[model samples]
Each structure stands twice: as C-alpha cells, then as structure tokens.
Target: MTKALKASGFLGLATMMAVGLHQFVILSGGNPVPPWMIGGHAHLGVLSILAIVMGFAVPALGVTGQLRTAVTVLYIAGQWGIPGIVWLGEGFGLTFLMPTGFLWGLALIASMLIMFYVTITGDGDAGDRGPTATAPADD
Candidate 1:
C-alpha cells in the first residue's frame, strides 16, 4: 500500500508538472487561462502532495491489510478522478461529467472518515503513543 501510494504520488506530481507547464504556455501566449485548467492544476498538485503524505501517515495510523487496500484505491481514484473529470467536463463543455466527479470526491471523503475513525478509536497498536507525558506522576 505504501509503495502504491508513493507511486501514485510521484505519478501525480509528474502529471501536475505537465499541466502546470501547459498553463504557463497558455499564459505566455497571452491567452486567458481556462477555468478548467486552473482547477485541474490546483487539484492535481494539492492531491499529489496529500498522496505522498498519506503514504507515510497511513502506516503510522495502523491501517493495514484489506482496509488499507480499500482506502488506498479510493484515495488514488479520487486524487485523479475529480480533476480529470473537471478537465473533461469543463474543458470540453460536457457538464454531464460533473456529477461523476462529485461522486469521486465523496469517495475520497469517505476514506478520510474511515481514517479519522480508526485514529480516534485506536483500531491498531502500531501507532500507540503510550502514556501522555502530562499525566501526574505517582506520589
């Protein structure tokens, strides 16, 4: 899962860079930036960074096995799907794709909720922080 997340992160970064350069070219040509391009560029860059961070944090959060697999898949799908759909829908003026993109975003949010639940409930011992340092010492 970690490798998958990191691979996705790097891939996303590469893709985002290409988009960014495309945006630069558009601006350099004195053409107004398309709204879809701006949206795609921002989402791709931010989500790519989140993917990299989640790669490290997931393990520390003790998410493992099948559940981890599910989360990873959902995260990757949302990370790319949302913006990709935006590019398709807005760039090509096919607004029908917006609902599908919204679904993708919801999936991403669901995965986040699962992570939050796991963290608060302490579902695994992998990330046990042990006793709090602020606890009063025995007399």
Candidate 2:
C-alpha cells in the first residue's frame, strides 16, 4: 500500500503540472477563455485526497471503507475523468476547466505524497525511527 501510494503521488503530480500549466495559459488570456469560468476550477486539484484513498484501507476501524469510497469519487470524477470532459467542452476553444484539470491532477499526486509522508513518517516525513516518541510503555 505504501508503495502504491508513493507511485500514485508521482503520477498525480505530473498530471497536476500539465493541467495546471494549461489552465494558466487559458486564464492568462492566451485564448478565448474567460477568467470567471476558470475561477475555483483549480480547487479540484487541491482536494484530491478523498479520491486517492479509494483503493487502500486507511487505518482505524470500519471507517476506512467509507473514507476510501469517498476518496475514490475525486479520483474518478475530479482528477481523472473531469479533465477530459472539460477539455471536450471548451479546452479546444480555451476555458479554465482545461487547465484546471492539470492542476487537479497535480494536486492528486501531491495529496498522495502527503498521505504517504504523514502515514510513514508521522511528523510530516522524517522516516520511521524515533521509538522514544511512539513507544507505549517501553521507558
């Protein structure tokens, strides 16, 4: 699961960069796209964790199932599928959705990276070693 998460993070980041760049172009008036339409479009990229956790089971208890399912939606609709739809609609002509997809994809990757980091490192990525901090009654 850790390996998978790491891999996903890399893929998601790449997607985000591409989509984000395209979105930037459209927003900067490179094409006929309007600014208003692109607004809030990048958010999809920012909140992709929900979709990323779909395949793996989160820690805790039975709650992992629900959480994973919810996460899957973002991957299916927000990160992976929506971009194509957005492009089809106005990407060719220039719209925020087109570039937004790139951002979203990048965000997805970032989320995965963050998740792995948090889960593996605990302190935002330092590697698993400090038993003194986590050990229960070992003292």
Candidate 3:
C-alpha cells in the first residue's frame, strides 16, 4: 500500500469497526447500547456503516476536489437521511427522550454540513486525480 493508504488505513479500520460495533450494539438488544440505542437501532447502525464507507473514500479524496465533493454529498445524504427518517418515524419512542428525535435530526443535519466541508477540502486516499490516483504509485 502507498503511504497515504497506509496512513489512512487505521482510520478506515477504526471507522469500519466502529460501524460494525454500532450494529452489534443495536443487534445486541439493549446489551451495550442501553435503552438509548434501542428502537431506532437501524438508524444508528446504518450511520456507522456509512461512516465506515466514508472513511474508505476519505483517502481517495487526496487529489481531485470534485470526487471529494461527490463523496461529501453521498456522506451527508447517508448520514442525515437515515437518522432523519428514524427520528420522524419514531419521535414518540422512549429512546428519543429529553432532546428527542428532533435533536438527533438536528445533529445529523449539522454533521452533514460539516461533512460537506471535510469532503471538499480534506485530503484522502480516494485520489481526486481520478481512478489512477487511487491505485498504488509503484503499480
């Protein structure tokens, strides 16, 4: 793997595991997530998976600004879309106590905005210089 790939790989692995753990937490049926992560388990679970996928794209975004922007759009969509849907669908759920689903939705919206910036400006292994940029330099 190239230096960029190697450097970013740890973040990728962490994100992937984090996503996978989020799923596991949800699937665990109140084991790890407690009462909060229940009910809308799918929403949180999907978000983590999206985060992991986004992490993979982070490295490729090292070159071209356009590809990174595209990744950002997708990231924002996935990040907020699922949570927003869940919050709207189950605003009355117990897990949505206190700040509630609306709060989560708001946070997700904010995150999407931040993601747009990160995707466009952040350097990643995803190689903004087109497909070849992602490929190993020695290859």
Best by lDDT: 1
Model 2, range 1-139, lDDT digits (tens) per residue? Answer: 3334434545655666676677778768857544433533453354334334433333321223444444443344445445454545464665544666665566456545544544664543233234323444666
TM-score of every prediction relative to native: 0.86, 0.36, 0.36
The sequence of per-residue lDDT tens digits that candidate 3 reaches over residues 8-64 is 334444544565577686767765544323434445455655565555555543424
lDDT tens string, model 1, 1-139? 9788888999999999998898899999999999889999899889989999889778878788877987899999999998899998999888988889878898799778878877888755555554422445699
TM-score of candidate 1 to 2 decimals: 0.86
Best by TM-score: 1
- In candidate 3, stretches whose alpha carbon ends up further than 4 angstroms from where it belongs are 1-39, 58-99, 120-126, 129-139
After superposing candidate 2, which stretches have Cα over 4 Å from the reference? 1-6, 22-44, 49-57, 60-74, 93-139
What's the C-alpha lDDT at position 73 in model 1? 90
Global fold similarity of model 3 (TM-score)? 0.36
State in Å the error of residue 19, model 1: 0.6
- Candidate 2's displacement at residue 134, Å, is 6.6
lDDT against the true structure, each candidate: 0.86, 0.47, 0.50
Considering TM-score, which of the candidate structures 1 and 2 is the better prediction for this target?
A: 1
